[model samples]
Target: MTARRSTFTALVTLLTFAGILVAPQASAASLVEVTAFGDNPGGMRMHVYVPDSRPASPAMVVAMHGCGGSGPGFYSGSEFASLADRHGFIVIYPSAQQEAGFGKCFDTWSDAAKRRGGGSDPVSIVSMVTYAQQRYGGDPGRVFATGSSSGGMMTNEMLALYPDVFKAGAAFMGVPFGCFANAADYPPGASRCTGNGGANRTPQQWGDLVRQAYPGYTGTRPRMQLWHGTADTLVPYSLLREEIEQWTDVFGLSQTPTSTDTPRAGWNRSRYGDEVEAYSIQGAGHSLPSSGMAAAALEFFGITGTPDPDPPVPGTCSVKPTVNAWNNGLTASLAITNNGTATINMWSLAFTLASGQTITSGWNATYAPSTGQVTARNAGYNGTIPPGRSVDIGFQATHTGNAAAPSSFVLNSTACSTG
Candidate 1:
């Protein structure tokens, strides 16, 4: 709900290397702090994560933190980082310094923050996006935004002000752009403006405000995906409708939903053409991003992952493999034993996957060439194996048919005894 991940205590351990431009730490994990990315009028901090195994020109997402939340905190809390790891995309987590009653927050209410290139939090955010594009060679057309609560409000703001910059956005429990006006009244009047006052405005008026942010801008407006709980009291649930109103109008689409259905049992979803989609979670007040929401959001962004196979298959496998099979997916774990007389350092286990199996992601060890003849290498921390010791590696993959173990295995070029 409120401060969804703001209470994470181990953010420092997760973030450690701030103000340093280092290489990707592991196969699929690295969070680096970039100081001079670009103009940062909002005085926000930038933390970027680029998975070791990713596309050459990866898609990018700006993940803003809620009030009282830090970039590293949200990175640890939200599933976007893991999804980024799976899809090989870049994530820009910006820490907001401005206070929004609860804690640190992106400037959603400020006049400067609301307008396009008006020079505030939104400007700082765009600077981060630009830096990601320039530094990481990110795909410009696939840039996106998603955040929770106040950060979610910034998500809406980014889409509204810089439609050219983002292809789409997902706002979890957020308000409409420009709805947080009346800075003099602040949080006291926040309820009034977002609740009774702002919710009453016609859809046209709300849409006009977004249009005015970047006046005369004639480009494809980024699509929107909004999530809100029915019983939210902090930022009333009614603003969900208000956000739908604003974006629908901005896209010149009808307010009447084109389709409505339950994405999950208690979660109702309404789609307005392809421009906007809103999810209302029943009885879930202010609480957001409930489990698989991040995955759904990334799917909406068209960042589908791939196994993209490794190489040609080889001989008999030499590892003890245990598998958990499901309908179309399976999880496999393989234990490799080092029975050599001497201690071995820096191990690479190579195995040929079964036919029709494609890996999505793996842990403990880094797997390359996700399918076919693949190689699993130890991470930075697990590079050594004493004699008579074993190291376990695992992967999750999608299978069209049989979920079998690797046909052959080779550990650092020496074929071991078959299991």
Candidate 2:
């Protein structure tokens, strides 16, 4: 390990042993796992992070990851840990079912998952927040959810389904309001124009539905952060602009931003009274770079603006990326550090592997190989990583074709470019 990682490891070990005795002195941050109630027996696991002294300190952001993502990766790479510590707030990430093969993906268009209170979907997420409030002390006044791609689509669904619960939503690379209908109408792969099913709605129609969804909320239209990359290929870029115009038309937002600034990356930010904001990153692609956009979300959470100098990358989660030729497998261990400003209550990790490797695991968890990827389950380490602290995970794998250890790494939830 590098000097910095070693130091972080030592500090995290100390804090883990300290438990709740120290109380974090300043704004405390830790990751905890809570069970979200649904109709099913294995409900769903949610990773939560909160400040030391809560109730009214800072708000919370329900950070949702994209397709095949895990709560732990979101907590680690998004820079939420450091941001929570600095701004004195909380961040929560909930896992989606892997029955679809990918780890944490929302079945946004599933007919069975969308029935009124029938599916183990939206209700499950709301149950998670309620659990946080009851056990971890979450603020009801200011609660929100932000997501990327599929996760972002879920954010829109949350706004539509649980309008009374969430204060606002931040969507990045997500489809517009009624985009789900496209998938549902086509039953599989339906482009925007093709899906004219009864479920589908135009952008304006979605805005109208959202307006009616929240009847009593006479307050300023719920705060929101809209983000998109001009180069986003998965979710059409034009949809973002259209969503912004439609949302503003329905909500009556100011024509321009309250404050405009560029903290990092090529992202141009537009803020509105700490309630609403948007970022249009220039030349960016797909998901937010875990470091930049995640930190941006933290700032939007009203956390302090001290950026993590060396935030953990997705690649840093494991250590000693190695391949076992004898067993025809590849393996590595990972360390998760809390580089954000708050505490993480719980976390889970998920990643896809290139073809040729089938994971047979050895660590704190087991490996389930499917669709050219490995899903490892690690539990019971609810250790708190103070700002800039690190935690580690170890794994060993078996290879099929020409499998080799990963050349890249992630530490404490952030993504590293190289081994």
Candidate 3:
């Protein structure tokens, strides 16, 4: 055991310095291998990492791997085990059976896997968690789960089918639970599986699917964080919108975002109260962000704050608004510029609409219209504005007679000069 620990530490140090390890792969000598079977059908193999100085009941995180990826690959790629070392938690990387189908992916699209009871993939995962808690002294209350791609789809299944087992979950580049009911529904391309688009379903209808997955359990729903790359060709970006709607409906939260911010370049987060949040990674495609996500998910789970040490402060930046193109009194193209030295994490622009005019639809921001008052908050992708950088947000409106632009605008509570 001592020699294995020494070798693991050396491998990690080399990988960190080389900056080449990111993503899940087959097990390494460092991870402790264990098979979970006998009780659960279609059993799984788990590669677990325990920190050196764990508490009596340390937090446990179960991470699932994407198609063609191994538990160790995910463990090394996400550096989740490294996080466990720092945070004193246990990290489990569970592998799907190769017979499960394409690239050894979890059987998330099959009805058998979606069921809550025994013989299903979801229940098999629960069994693994139970083993961790019983054998390794894991805290039952602080269990969390996360995954990417097909594994992410499985993560969705776990959250919906076993909400009582997981306090929170995060899925990257994956669809909502029950998105695809069968293999035939999967897209032909490299894109991940997505079903129905949920376009025809009401919020209540979508929430009903989740409730039916568990059947008669009325415990607190698990919190969720969703991440997707906007430029991914495989999975449509619109799927992220559908997923947000599904979980928010389950939590009974409004569609409108409670807060929006760009924590870094290419990463925009829209938070819905505290129950659900979504991150849109700008210009990224089909993979997890190369850095920071593991720690970020842990921070979301209340495990540690190593990722975001400094909490966000309200911006004091100056905003300048410009009217790019105004349609025949009905539509307008507008742009806002950040003119402050510091990057603005979140921004909101407010202006009173002209009498008898109302906003209909908007882009690059969320528009909330009231009687003579209109507020637009940054959308997921445009929330972070670096110094001197600008983003465009536009809206279409209906007017009875003459259409006129609002005289002034306020951004983040500071008055903005109309350009």
Candidate 4:
């Protein structure tokens, strides 16, 4: 047997000896199995946990398992369910169908699983998200995915394939999206992408892979949290860099991190403008996130001990947009008027820019995320507006071809008329 397999076995045995291992079937006691959740194209099973306390629109998390693991098994081994009980959110544990006795593994290597609406594990997982939304009034805007090893790979896949669904994800010991391509020989299969393959792609090359996963996708990409061990042998330790490169490029961040610090002793973290964050556990092994990870992941997902932001009420504002267009770019202006009864101390205008359209610079307000669902917050000079008064903010955005106007104007949680 290869040393990696031997080490994997030894780690599993050690976790089992430490009472961290639980049988897949035994997890059913805590998580209710949901068969016929969808067409089951991936042949995966679904299990869910609903806390007694729930918000009117509680958030939902899809907690996936690694190879040789089942949904309930992960549900038991992971802290998400207990966190759900405390936080009033729901958790879904998905169990992949055992493949050729190789162990139950989510399909991150298959073409069917890589693309959008391709009808495989990914489609099945989306169906589960839809099921949760329809059945439990789950907040569509707050869905998230997380996993370890194989499941971690799927977390990257989920964000890439369905950014419209997931706001963010935390992937543990995961490789870059499409890292398994051309390498079906993993874990006994001789592959170049894992275990000393030496992650050779440039950041743009890796970003192209993620963009290709869902062609023509122009939405604001979901954020990512990456965790990996420095001493991993099953998956190459260098993959953490590849994953970082891929996602930072997607979020339009430079390779250099905005901040670097140690969250805890022995755990080094680098954050790329909050769009991508990588945590390196020094001297750790395969399958990272030893403990106290779920809470941190939840924090990244904005699910603090409290619930999600309350749904906004009917808007009492107006947005007037004017644009000066060129062949490759445009300068757009917005007039935000306050129609509320009281004076506004602070204001933020939220809108969605077309795909490929990125804000290069702006005046009168601060723009964030350049593209996708963007927030233009008032600068210090324009933070206050009296009733019946208007604030003018303009930004210059670059676009390759599509120069359509931004839409879905929301000012401080109030819907605004885009007149």
Candidate 5:
């Protein structure tokens, strides 16, 4: 009886601790619906959150939702409403329409949606900003925009199409403006988005894309903040590099990062002067990080009194590859290791496939093959690689004659030796 009681007590204690680990944090603000209060040009539903202590002319933020996510969900998930409550700001969550095949995603990839001064989605979002400033006593000059995933892509579109409207914008897990020329090019997963690495375009070439988004615009461009999970398989982590390069060129900042901050073990910030800041959240997946990203964005826009905490020492990670099995010029298995001090949230592996070999199917990653080059991004579950841990991913390929392993392998953009 004594042994049984001790085991039961230990089990109860462990379960309690587990519950604490997974419990959701309480939200600081409540969401309120404002029906038909603004011009519904794009026919979007508005869910606004206004703090009780909102001062006169409070700053307004237009928050957008990702594909298949509603405004309320975004409000709850991003904790934007909570931040608004604390900071005395107004937050507008614009819900998207269910387009024919794309579900609830803003048409940011289309030319019509990217245009300025029209009744399209971009213009409609700007109208929301205008409405917030007019009816909600929002500061027009201090208005900002932010979103995640597809919404993040829309955020980029807004900044480029209406540079004068937004003082600053942040995009999490998004692509650059005009990355896809049209709807047909819009792949089901953004991991396949074009211009992932700027397509080797020069700074001028990339800047020209943004310039063309708004014709004859010479206003001061809005500042930009980009955040990406290092382990995001849905959107390749390499795309973050392209986004920074494109924006830095548009802002005419040097290519090198002006400042690098590791706010904690798994967070990193690379500032390109004051106009552009890119955050790489180590061990984070496709979701918004809980480590004060919303607060940091508010501070960057100067809308909130809270300042970002100084980053701590950055974490390091190393990658190793091992061939698990190769069969009859047809099947193969590979394993990778994270041999570093911190957890890896997102990762990309690149290698040269043996000549005449073609990948047919892969698991635990988004596989892309191009003329002797192959790149695989982390799938949702396999991205988090803890320190001194390992994960296995496998692929099937067809080879003409020889099925030898390639001579080189790179992980997270760093070269690695095969184990």
Candidate 6:
């Protein structure tokens, strides 16, 4: 009898601990309807994932849906729930207004949406965020968004129209076609998706409009990521490429890169200044492939990435920056500047060298010649750099027999040219 009672007590104790271990940390899971207040919210329905711990964690993100889709569809298909589970972050999926017409897109770039009186989607988005913070536990400081197709276009529009509302945004296969074009050509000119009383404008027109708006805009441009398939039939590749070029040019980015096919079968990758980047897949089209784009984008959004199996810190790198040389290699000095407000723990730059010449030696960093890469380690020994500080790391190398010194280089993941 004594033995049985002891065994039962032990079993009960173990079970209780196990239950505690498995319990979720969030306070409550709430599904709230964000009323458009009779303003026609584009039929947007909102659902939130709030944790048990209130105010302790950041309510990380809210993702909007594309044309003809709802919040549930985006949440279930995008695998955002799993990300929420892993990161202990809250995610809200919000729907857009739907109309009983041939086209089902939000008039993202419309001038009406820009004004206070118009049934603006940006206002609705801001309202949703405000509601989440007030009623639900949302950390306004860390809010971000990622959208697809029409949702992506809205993401771009929101960045331009409501730049202060979000810290960051990712556009997957979406571009603000009409907003960037000439207002006059757009019919009801500049009224959102349907221009001039609901007429649609072409990509060229959209680009022209954006150019005109660029000079006088006073708001800061938030961080953004643009992902599109090279072969996307739904949104032509040409339009996306033009937008990419236009944005980089507008930003005054100096670096220009030639595309090279990545080892990943159909992938082609190119880099401009640290400000602009693009990836194109030769045979891939329309949608995201299973592999790297999302992960890459997540990194771009400042989200923590998969811990490097072996953190790349504590490594030394080499570079032989130079000018003109018959060997297709020249001696030059490379300077790395920290643009962000915080100190970077570590950073790496990867690029291919001209077929023959190679990097010989780099300072305060290490060089991996075989991979054509450079990695720097400043942990512990190197202190934090004050905001807007610059660090100079140079390299020394001799051009191999009869090879021309390499003229261009990539820094901190951005391409750089001599000119």
Give all candidates' CA lDDT scores: 0.79, 0.58, 0.73, 0.80, 0.73, 0.52
lDDT by residue (80-176, candidate 1, tens digit) is 8777877789999999998767678888888888778888889999998998888888999999999998789889999989999999999998888
Task: Pull out the clashing pairs in model 1.
Answer: 1-286, 1-287, 68-104, 316-408, 317-407, 317-408
The TM-score-based order of candidates, best leading, equals 1, 5, 3, 4, 2, 6
**Best of the candidates, TM-score:** 1
RMSD of 2: 12.2
On a 0 to 1 TM-score scale, where does candidate 4 land against the true structure? 0.65
Instruction: Evaluate model 1: give its TM-score.
Output: 0.67
For residues 1-419, write the lDDT of model 6, one tens digit per residue. Answer: 89997996787789777874222222344434444323334445666666554356465676766667777666554545444655556676777664423335555645665443345566676676776666555677777777777677776666655545666677776665344333332222233333222324443454445445434565655566566765455565554565465445545554365333353434465666554456664433444422344445555566656423222212223335444455545543545555555443334334445554566655654444422333332211222333456555555555556443343454433344432
Tens-place lDDT digits, model 2, residues 265-297: 356777755665678766544645333566656
Residue 379 accuracy (lDDT) in model 5? 61
Error of 3 at 281 (Å): 0.4
Cα RMSD (angstroms) for every candidate in the order listed: 15.2, 12.2, 11.4, 21.0, 12.0, 16.2
Q: How does model 2 score by TM-score?
A: 0.58
Q: What would the per-residue lDDT of candidate 3 be over residues 151-262, giving only the tens digit for each residue?
A: 7778788899889999999888878787775765654352334423433456676688898898899899999999998766556677788778889999999999999998
For candidate 6, what is the TM-score? 0.54
After TM-score superposition, the amount by which residue 88's alpha carbon in candidate 2 deviates from its true location, in angstroms, is 2.9
* lDDT (C-alpha) at residue 348 in model 1: 64
Per residue, candidate 5 scores C-alpha lDDT tens digits across 99-171 of 7265688877666787787556886677767767777678988989999888888888899888989999999
Strongest candidate by lDDT: 4
lDDT (10s digit) by residue, model 4, range 1-419: 59987997798899889988432221322677777566678988999887777799999999988888888778766668767877888898999884723687888877788778887899999988988888778999999999988889899999999999999999998888887764264453366677575467999998998899889988888999999977677787788999999999888899999999876545798999978999987655563454456777898999985223332323378889998889899999999888877655445677999888999999987676677888776654565677888999999989989888888998856789888
